[model samples]
Each structure stands twice: as structure tokens, then as C-alpha cells.
Target: MRNQVVSRDEWLKARVALLEEEKELTRRSDAVALRRQELPWVRIDKAYRFDTDEGAASLGDLFRGRSQLIVYHFMFGPDFTAGCPSCSAIADGFNGFAIHLAHHDVMLWAVSRAPLAKLEAYKRRMGWTFPWASSFGSDFNADFSASITEKQQREGGFEYNYRPAAPLTSRAAAGPVAEYAATTGADAATYMRERPGMSAFALEDGAVYHTYSSYSRGLDGLWGMYQWLDRAPKGRNEQGLWWRRHDEYERA
Candidate 1:
């Protein structure tokens, strides 16, 4: 729907009123970030390993000599022939910021269940320079609640975004789930097994600690396209899945 047309003076008045609410939201967002920083850390005891271009790496090694690490749990399962389009879009934004983050003592990486070769191929295709590591043949994805097993899917035993979810049924074989699954060349069940998330780790006192993690909509802030869309005249204005991998878009 079109906004009501108005004179400049009226528009300025309305915008000024909205500015107050926007300021309040900014303050609240700041407070929430502080709370996130204050969340207690869980010591990581398991020796999680990942396959990277550098070779096999322990979770601590992901920090790459930095004190902090942030890993995007990219939704590319071992069975997937392509990365999730949604994840590809999110990664597209981070690919540029990763170098800045690295310089600021934070190492940013994307971890997926796909094999290293698959990840390398996709990374080349996407032209992403950000570090990507494969959690294939490891429990890292499942332990972190990023990937689930078929048993978990059948038994309704999985939780995503920290909430218990119902077992995957035929219901997932339609709608956006099926649509996204097809894009990755997988069945809905296989696609849904791999979820999108981000996890933060801190290397302190010679040990790695899991400091924070966010999943599902909790990751909205990190999706750069959404941030731009939120400020657009039409806001998100989304209907169903309207995104694709950056390169997949047709030239104007």
C-alpha cells in the first residue's frame, strides 16, 4: 500500500515523531548487546575439529591467534549439492566485513557439515574470501544444535532457536521448506536437518569457551540485506522467499 501523500512540512513532522521511537529502539538494542556480552560462558571440553584449507583445526584454532571467534553455522549439509540460498545471501555480507573483524582481534568463519571440497567449490563459486571450514565427520554441528540426525527428526527430539520443535513430517515437504530444499538439491527432511545459526567463542586462560549463540530469527541482525531492507521505503516488504544467492540474480 502507498503511504499517504503529504507536504514536506507534514512529512518532517511525522518523521520527527518516528525518530523518537527509533532512538528508543537504538537504546534498547544497545542494552540487549550488553546483556549478550554479560552472558555466562560455557567451557568447551570436547575437542571439536574442522577441515579447513589450512588443514584439520581444533575449535580453538578457529580463533587464528585472536581472542574471539565467531562462526556462522552455514546450512550446507553433507548431502547438499549447493549452499542454502539464504545462507549464501548472509555470507555475502560477512565476506567483506571479515577482514575488518580479523584486524580487530576477532576471527570470523563459516562452518558447515559439507565436506571441505564441497565448501571450497561453493566458496570459489560465490567468490567469498572469508574462511570456511567443514564440520564433516565431526559432532560439532550436532553438539551445537546446528545439525540434527534422522533419528532426531523422526523422534521430535530436536530444538532450534532454543525451542523444542515438532518432528519433521510431510508438512515440511511443501511450502518454503520444500522450496529451499529443492534449491539445495536435497529432500525437505535433509535440508531441514541443517539449520542456520551463529556461535561466539572466546579463547581465555588457554581454553576455549562457548560464549554465545543465536539461531533462527536471532540472526536477523547479521543478515546485511535485511538491515538495508528494513530501512528501505517499503521495509522488508517480503512475501515468501524472495532472496537468492547474490550471483543468481539476473542482470538488469
Candidate 2:
């Protein structure tokens, strides 16, 4: 339902009051960002490799000569015929911003567990030019806690966001999880095998260091659509998995 309508003078007063709070939030967000940058960085030593359009490339190569690298842990498992719709939604935003980030001494890539061929075909279908690499036989996704198997999900030994993640059970779950699972051309069990996240790396002195990572709701700000919806009249107004790939949306 709509909020109460008030006089123009009253509305102006309320808006001005909200503006002050928004300014304060902006200041707090800046401080938090500064603190995030101040976090300790852990050096990555393992030989992480990925399959790319230009053949095999090491984790360091992903930076593309940039000092910083941002990898979106796209949820496209080896068994999946297509990418996850939710991740695709996020990629829609990245597709536009990736180029701009590249020009600013930063590289952005979408890393998935799917083989290079599947990633290539889907990328063409989606018309995304952003760099996406396949980590099919690599531990890059597992090490970053982005990809998980039924065994890992059952045993539950890994940590996501520095906390114990809930164990995954093999059952037909309802709601968005099941809904999104269907679109991936995999059973719900196979679909739930993968999770979404993003990791940031820094390349310095011929070494790559894990600087930061975010998962689940921590990634809200990176989603451009939600950022816009948050300011809209209805403000998301989401009931369930109402989003899809841009091409999937029906024309008016």
C-alpha cells in the first residue's frame, strides 16, 4: 500500500529530514570501505589454473596486467547447461561495468566451474563480452568457498563468510531455490551444488594475495538493479524469484 499523502510543505520537511540521514549513511559507508581496505591480505601460494578462451591461464594471468582483480563466482556448474539466473542478473550489471573497471587499472572476470565450451556458448547467448573463465578442474572456486559438492555439502566442513554454512540436504526444496534450479537444466540437487560469491585479489611482486571476498547478502551493493530498486516507488517489492535474464523478459 502507498504511504500516507501529505501536504507539499509537509513532504518537503520530511524529504529534507531524510536527506540528513542519507548523508550520515554515506559518511558511515565511507568509513566501512576504508576499514575493509585496511584488512589483512593472505598470500595465495597454490598453482591455481583456469581454462580461458586463450588457453590455460594462471590466477595471476587473470589480472590482465592490472594490479587488482575482481572475480565474480558465477554459479555455472559443470552439469549446468546454462548459467544461474540470479547470477546472470548480477552479471547483467557487471557486463556494463567490467569494461569501465578494466580501463581503471582493475580487471573483472566471471569464474565458473563449468567447462570453457559451456561458458563460451552461454556467454554468446547472453551477449556478454566480460571476461569469463572456466575453473572446471581447478580448486580456485573451492578454495574461495564458491563451489561445493554434494559430499562437502553433506559433511559440512567448509566455511562461508568465515562462518559455518548450513549443511545441504538432498531434497526437493521449494521457492526461489527450486525455481532457479530448474532454469539451469540440472536437478535441484545438482543445482544446489554451487553457490555464488565474489573474491578480490591483489597482484604485487609476482604474487597474488587474497584481499577480500563477499557472499550472500553482503553482495547487495554490487547488484546495480537492486540499488536502483531500493530507490524506486515500490522498493524491490519482491515476492519471490521474479527476475530473469534480460532476454527472458517479455516485451511490452
TM-score of each: 0.97, 0.96
Clashing pairs in 1: none
Error of 1 at 159 (Å): 1.4
Give the C-alpha lDDT of model 1. 0.93
Q: Mark the 10 consecutive residues where model 1 has the least summed lDDT.
A: 243-252
Error (Å) of candidate 1 at residue 134 is 0.6
Error of 1 at 218 (Å): 0.6
Q: Model 2, 1-252: lDDT tens per residue?
A: 569899999999999999999999999999999998999999999999999999999999999999999999999999999999889999988778888999999999999999999999999999999999999999888889897778877788778877987777645455678878888998777887788899999999999999999999998998889999999999999997788888888851
Return the top candidate by TM-score.
1
Question: How well does candidate 2 match the true structure, expressed as C-alpha RMSD?
Answer: 1.6
Clashes of each: 0, 0
